[model samples]
Target: MRFGMALPGPNVAAVDCLPLDVLPLILEHLTDRRDLHTCAQLSKAFHNAATPLLYRTLDVRVTMYTGMQRAIVLHPSTTILQRPEYAKYVRHVRENGAVGFHRPDLMDDCRKALKMCVNLEGFTWSDDSAEGTDEGDFMRYLDILQTLPLRELVIQTFYGLSDSVWAKLQDFSGLTKVSIWCMEGKPRILQGWSEKLGASLTHLELGVSSLSRAPHPLYFLSHLPRLRALRLKGAPSAAILEILTFLPQLETLDTEYFGAALTRYDDVPAANLRHLTVRTSSVHIQGFQQLWPWIRRLTPRPSLESFTLNAFSTQGEALVPRSFILDMAATHKDTLKRFKADSTQMTLKDIECMCTVFPNLESLSCTTMWSPESAPYEEAVQKANKLRELRLNLHDWRPTHVRLAGLNNANIEVAVRNMMLREGAALRLVGIGSIVYRGQWIYKKAEDGSDKVEFEITSNVIKDVWD
Candidate 1:
């Protein structure tokens, strides 16, 4: 052994003899933090190898509270931070909580811990939206993000960023993926943040955020040639399609909450977009007759591959126009691999269109109120040779259940799952799903473990997440 250690009897390799560098390389592959934490306590050699990997992604929400964050947790007196050494290994810092930072002493300790993260590349802060004018408040904590090799910044709200803070952000470079969600859209924010942060960004997501004056913030941001991925939400539908035309290089887009309106516009030019997702969150938008009518306006793109249209109304009774499904399925038929839609209901014609139009589809989902005899889904199931994943949204069974006619009152809901696997024999898996009729439409995993999802909807609650 290199460290003057003798191994027991026959086997000669000592644990210490393993190159310290090689151990860190091996430890990187150990993803379970619990296992890594246990390994870190083994010896100084293992500790040194595992500690860096442990602090690699500093999620403040968990890091502030987790017992595993030994280096940052306070002592019995709750007045001291134990190890400053752990901070340097942090590369991603996500701060979604403000637990121990109330006292100046504790806040300093937290900042001191963060100051050592010179290698931090990613940072997210959700509490920056507070309106308190306290100097060196949460913004001071945010300034710590500017120092490191910051690459991704996902800030929740910018409620009180002054001009100076905004100016600092403009000069702060090296950002690539920036997602500003739930922003208050104060006057100052609508004016400059996009233009300030737009230059260095490649993947930008602005959801439920507002912009200043006439020429929309997105319209102004379209000039930035570097943008490749975009997600726009809480904007008028009238302006969104036009904005897409402006960004010809965009490869991916996810948008929703388009304020319903019938603003007449010319044909939208097709870009090299590959993945597109359009969603209508609130059922309040009455004009959301269908997702395809809005999508059909766009000129066809040969590069388009994935399309998802989630049209959710309050009543769970919104319709997804057949023309929209057929047209989209036809336009992206060649390259389309994944297609998901949540309409009021779907029929055999819709399923046939989807199965036949998309031969290369690897994944397909629909919020269809399925019946055993409604459509011969078997029709196109054979043609969809590459089909691997299929998710169906059927009516929940309880008081009155739809049954497969011949199968002894067999819930057609369950029968549909078998039908998919039997018909699309090439399918890798068929996931059976149903929207909750009552409390939050949650998708619960089937306890029986036949790769099924069984949900018992209760209450009149509602959920916002996509099915």
Candidate 2:
């Protein structure tokens, strides 16, 4: 009887005594996957607890083939391929099946892995071929997708899918967000198919290759009652306006180009629109003036929240006037929150005028081709009090003898610094200089009421400066 008596170590009993539910909570705190893998190997209980968390969010991107190879090499001991318990954690992959000449066996294994992931919520299919054909394999993968309900689906194809596969997508009733980047001719067939699934779609992105022609698939989106976000690139402005008229509840509208013809259709207004982005070299100050007035004339004017203009170019030798920007901001001041302009030859005075108009703006970013004249820095700072994010490009300022006549390097730096400080707690990011000053960049951040500024100058800039 005495020989049968045994004693336990001090912490041994306590370690085994902890509840099984607490294991997951502890493993979640681990930051690195290697640390989690080590924890999993400690015991079978630990393995079961950590395996799901580790296997969740599987990335099968073409770029991550090395990681896939490693996973395959360790498949025998890890048994992740055969284990059903790990399937629930698998939510996404860059590709669904195999392709090309390498690793032919990986195709079957990857499909098997995908099948086990019946609870997947996100899926992205990116084809590497510039002109390669994968229609059959793509169709097979789409068939498999029908089994899993997904919230997000992203498809990037160098060429378009077959019409049969596009028709089969009607069954994807649970899809809420979809992004399609199809080859030039392929998007034409999508019109009817998109209309079929329009009721359930909330976010839709279409990137086409043709900008001069009408988007053939435009009619398919005419009934997207639930659609809130719509992004169209490389499509004619007429087609874009046609789509905008259909989306009654639309919240976001982003277009790559605004054709000169858009001015003719100013009579059609998107009343429910809130966020708008126009990345067009065609838009000038005059075009914007004509466009904004029509937008303001909507019966129930849209509460435009965020506006972005990119790649804007002006005719002849013209600079964006300070008063013009100020007037535009004042017209939409009540509902605006974020305002951005890039690639415009504007001056510091023009930016300050914008700040005065949209004093409640939370995010402000502008690329000016002309630096400020050494006037009063406080005036610019006072106008940008509510700015949260600020981006100023001194390189955007043209170094004309006329503009930089009286300004020196010290004066330019002081003016830029003052503009940033005015953003206060709202400033989270800042970028300075151009290609010539490539490495000479400054960034600042504020945390817990403390401000930190960092200056990083590249070797190229330092060498050129000293040379």
Per-residue alpha-carbon lDDT of model 1 for 58-160, expressed as tens digits?
6543233446433253321121136565666778766543434433355665666667777778877665526523335556766776677788877675463
Model 2, range 1-467, lDDT digits (tens) per residue? Answer: 11112324554355456688987897777767777787576556667667776876665433345456532322221244767677877766567333433445565666676777788888888764556446666776777787886788887777655667677666677678888776644543345556656668888887874233444555667767788988887766555656666677888888765544443444465546788887666424555444443333322352778887665546522345565565556556777888776555556676677677776788766665433455554465466667655554443233434333444356655555555544452443444343122222355666776667664432111111101
Clashes of each: 1, 6
- Residue 343 miss distance in model 2 (angstroms): 1.8
Clashing residue pairs found in predicted model 1: 439-458
List the candidates' TM-scores in order: 0.71, 0.70
What is the lDDT, from 0 to 100, of the residue 84 in candidate 2? 69
